[model samples]
Target: MNGLLKKQFGLVLMLMLLAMLMYACAPDEAPVDEGGSSDEEESSSDEGSSEDSSNEGSSDGEISGELEIQYFVGGYGDSWWKEVISDFEEEYPDVSVTEHAGPNINEEMRSRWVSGDPPDVVYIDGAGSSETQMVEDDQLMNLTEWAEGIELEDGSSLVDSFIAEPSTYDGELYSLPLVFDAWGTWYDMNRFEENGYEVPKGFESFMSTMGEIQENEDIEPFVTTGQHPYYFSRGMLYPAFAAHGGNELLADIVQGAEGAWETEEAEEIMSNVEEMVDAGYVDSGLGALNHTQSQMNFLLGDNAFIPVGFWLPNEMEGDKPEDLQYGFIPSPMNPEDEPMAIVPDLRPLAIAEEAENPEAAKAFVEFVFTREYAELFSEHTGAIMNLEGVDLANNENVPEYLIQANEMINDPEQVEIFYKPHPMSADLETPISDSLVSLLLGNITAEEFIQEAEEAAAEYREGQE
Candidate 1:
């Protein structure tokens, strides 16, 4: 009887040890929900969830939803943007797209914001207008999160060269930089060769050539419109400002500091403008002219050089005289200062904060960033592709000087968005531009011009506060 009892005890001990080992290795299932269940069962159920968490689906795919996009395309003046949108619709069939043309895009957007009805995605001119204000107001989406998963064509950062930090606010990206537009001096090569003049090397050389052309060839060396201040700010004045001071002046001005325009560095710039007026480099008629008039003169070859953007090729298309060999160069710089290139203004598309289909808007931005769409845009507009790894087209329409300008951008040391950083306001560029025109027309002395500009700038700052 004692031996039988000892055997039973040993057998029970072995069974208990075996049960413990099984519990350690096995996954716990959901505890049978018994209101009377012990703590041990709940602990067992929690352990089972760890394995399931690791198996969650992580596949990436395009999503679909109702999306509304408001785009302004007056400058493009063609089917290019329309075609691209149609292509987007076909590619993402499930995404229902509603398109509204934002007439007077800036004013329309401002009105819509007041009415509390803004579009999901919209396009605004990058000529340093009201778009920057929207970014500051946090009206745009923070695209960094959405861009992380994207793999660009070259397997690099999704937002490549032209589309990066310029749209950033407080270290977070707000909008996408779409097509790149850089301002420079557009020229007619046929006329240049015909006149037997070497391309101007620097500011002095350019002015000398302009003088010679005016005196000998009887052509308007340069033509500009002073009626709109943007022409002066972007095309003539700002470029000269960057040339004189190493591009930091504008940023300093934006940050409540004086710009080089008020410093000794600006003497060369102001002197150049004064010299142009005295020597007849620019048309004497510019006092009443407008931006379109400047481009019109260049296209007619009545003016040899016009300050404009790469988009001039598209803008001048039908109006461009036959056999017009047009090209572009960096706006003439102060000979001593290091060369500075404009960070091409990006035609960014931003999703409104209240956008009903934020995901679809983001997806559209992603799709447009792809090489196919980027290349399509470049081809259509004769504009540079914003995507990485895509080569600048060597087509018949691309001007040689534009190619040279693009080379200047390759140097990381020289290219920057310094001048373009100012947020748009009715009070900012307009007042300064008018002051510049006043200086040109001898209505305001240079010192008076500087003081008035500073006063207007101070008012803008106060409004912001």
Candidate 2:
């Protein structure tokens, strides 16, 4: 895989780690903290202008300036960003958007942020750049006032339209999550229909389906990016943990709570995957395949399932099998459990606090978060925007899989978690990944995998102290 099509295994790894950690400890229901805002006040669509930042320019609402923007250009391509920019600039004809985007954007923007020459706004989603670090260093502007004070075209407060809490410091939003997706398993819907196979609704049925596929046909039932097992963490292994203990057990282990990692739960979790492998459901050749290869294997009808994110269709746009009806279902880690979606805290676009053009940066934020742009984002990328009222069902161009995911995520009955519980440390990524690899490869049992990860977590926590 190369060019705009190549998969960034590392990005997948980071996101999965987050999926594993963040929500493990998340509250059952995290309402936007009202600090000083009241229920009657919040229920009103129009917020008083008190939150308008003192730094906001007196523009008479005519947004015009040079806005510098950068975004990641990977499988989730930059066409949507460019389209939004064009619309923004057309609306403000006097404005010019300078875009510096690509797969390497995070690295490219590094020196600029260091030299205090970063762009006015950056779409900080992909592999690099840390929104938390940037926030801690005071490099990004706080959107508290504007986000709360400004009314959208619909009269809704800008922040009120999102499912996200205005995760703020001193009522300030350091970053907002604009785009959201969960890693999941996809199958050939047509194949399932033809074979009389029901889409698995729970992990038990999912595993049984895998066994049935192998038992009833020569085709392999499952194939993942064997070279990148973390792909399994989201729709696969994490669901297993969620299955047995719900997020409570997961929270204990991931949050570094006392005596958390040292448990039989780890052993139990590994058994889920082990039983599948023992059932001969996993492809033997999986170890040699990369993400694209394995994905193609499923698309070509050589395999029945591939675990991937919502980006799979776009990434394989050119190579996808003709007339193939792709189908997706969240990993049914536990069949009897209620609906759940693996949401992660990948950061969104934010203005640099040191932005030379603060006004333009704010305008850019406003432009992209609108209903029109959110719809366009979903139509173009097949992923839902985290912003409120941006439903895939509203866009006919959106794929069925995305629409399904959008509905599942927003279903009030379902629980969503912003994943990525990488040990709250700087150095645990590799070692933890190594432990997962060991567990998957059978080089280490589940107990061993948990021990190694716990050891790494211990080292990370100590360093934090």
Best by TM-score: 1
- What local lDDT does model 2 show for residue 193? 88
TM-score of each: 0.78, 0.76
Per residue, candidate 1 scores C-alpha lDDT tens digits across 307-380 of 77677777667787888887776677546345554535556777787775666777777777777666666667
* CA lDDT, every model vs. true structure: 0.65, 0.69
Per-residue error (Å), model 1, residue 116: 1.9
Q: Candidate 2 clash total?
A: 11
Which one wins on lDDT? 2
Report residue 246 deviation for candidate 2 (angstroms): 4.5
Could you give me the TM-score of model 2 versus the true structure?
A: 0.76
Q: Cα RMSD (Å) per model?
A: 10.3, 21.4
- Give the per-residue lDDT of model 2 (tens digit) for 74-165: 77787898788888888865566788998788898799989988888887765556565577568888777667676667888877777554
Ten contiguous residues with the weakest lDDT in model 2 = 45-54
